[model samples]
Target: MTNIYNEINALEGAFRKTAEFETLKEAVEVVKADEEALNVFKNFRKIQIELQKKQLAGEDLLEDELVYAQKAAQLAQQNEKISAMLEAEMKVSKVIEEVNRILLKPIQTLYEDIQ
Candidate 1:
């Protein structure tokens, strides 16, 4: 209930950070794909499957609880993606720093030659 909602909110908040969001998103996707096999989603799947059938028949889910869970999924996905992006960014930054260090050695050599 409240705990679920809080996790949803935190995921949403971290959504914009691409690396984190990607990481979170992958986790969320995995959780969703296995929800049918997972205990927590087992009970809900019955209703969810029915809801999907109804939706296909032109009826839609109108309950706030269902919507909240869906939102939680999206939020979690976004957070995962953001986390991933951050990690990638860190790696790229490190690579750039290393490159700069290597390039400076050549510049130093050239300066020494000029002198």
Candidate 2:
């Protein structure tokens, strides 16, 4: 078995001679890639928030449309009631005219007798 102290020293010497390991510039570039990936995640999160806002806006629009439809239907019903009332008023006016004609016979006879 290899002596532990000798192996440790030999590994240290080999690391000192190796320049192919991570240099300062290569390590900085790796850190920049990590930072850029983090920014991409942040931007994606912002897009998700914007999408949620748009969905809420769409829901509000649909609600407003429903409200308007309900108002329009109510107005239509009110107009129908008004129309029915007008028709009843015209019928009453016709009845009144007929009653006047029927009652005019005795009134004219009295007026002629007085004259």
Candidate 3:
């Protein structure tokens, strides 16, 4: 039988070498080089994480928090380096989503067969 862990590790290595991953790495480095951009990105990420946590905990999002998040997002978009990094991140996310779908095919097929 094939070792699933080994296969997963191999997949991870291959994923790291993909163009999307490389672009994201470069974009991150560019953001890191720009202090202002990095600060904006970090602030946005912090707000995002806080909002996500609140959502996961079943707590309501306050108006101020939503407004802050919106403003942070707008600020992040205004920073060229941060914007590039976000775009690169989206590309990497798409690749990961496709990989996840591919990996779930066996389970999906099994469920369909049961139905």
Candidate 4:
């Protein structure tokens, strides 16, 4: 069996150079420049992760945590820097998702043939 590690590395470098990734990087810098916005965003992410983990574990979410998440979402919506960063992040995620779909097409077809 052959490994495509080098090709994967090359694709990683290429992905970084893509326009989507570049825009995401710029958005990240904008967020980094605003300390308060960055901190708020970080807190929101932490809360989001914690909530998701709880949900996946079938644990009930605390009322305080729910309120905090709501407040965080509102604050992020009002913050231009954070909104831009989130939009850029979504764009990058979409690009990566499309790339993965494309890369998996051949494997998907092989599976279909076996079925």
All candidates: CA RMSD in angstroms? 19.4, 45.5, 1.0, 1.7
Across 1-115, the per-residue lDDT of candidate 3 in tens digits comes to 9999999999999999999999999999999998999899999999999999999999999999999999999999999899999999999999999999999999898899674
RMSD of 2: 45.5
| Alpha-carbon deviation at 96 in model 1, angstroms | 1.1
Model 2 misplaced stretches (Cα beyond 4 Å): 1-78, 112-115
Candidate 2 per-residue lDDT over residues 42-110, each given as its tens digit: 444455465567677884435665565555444433543333433444555565576567668788887
> With candidate 1 superimposed using the best TM-score fit, by how many Å does residue 77's alpha carbon deviate from the native?
12
Best by lDDT: 3
lDDT tens digits, residue span 1-115, model 1? 3786887577556544556445545544555565443434444455567667878999767788577657644443355443343455466566557657875897788789674
> Which 10 consecutive residues of model 2 have the lowest summed lDDT?
19-28
The TM-score obtained by model 3 is: 0.95
- Identify the superior model by TM-score, candidate 1 or candidate 4: 4
- Residue 27's lDDT within candidate 2 is 38
TM-score of each: 0.28, 0.27, 0.95, 0.89
Candidates sorted by TM-score, best first: 3, 4, 1, 2
Instruction: Give the winner by TM-score: 1 or 3.
Output: 3
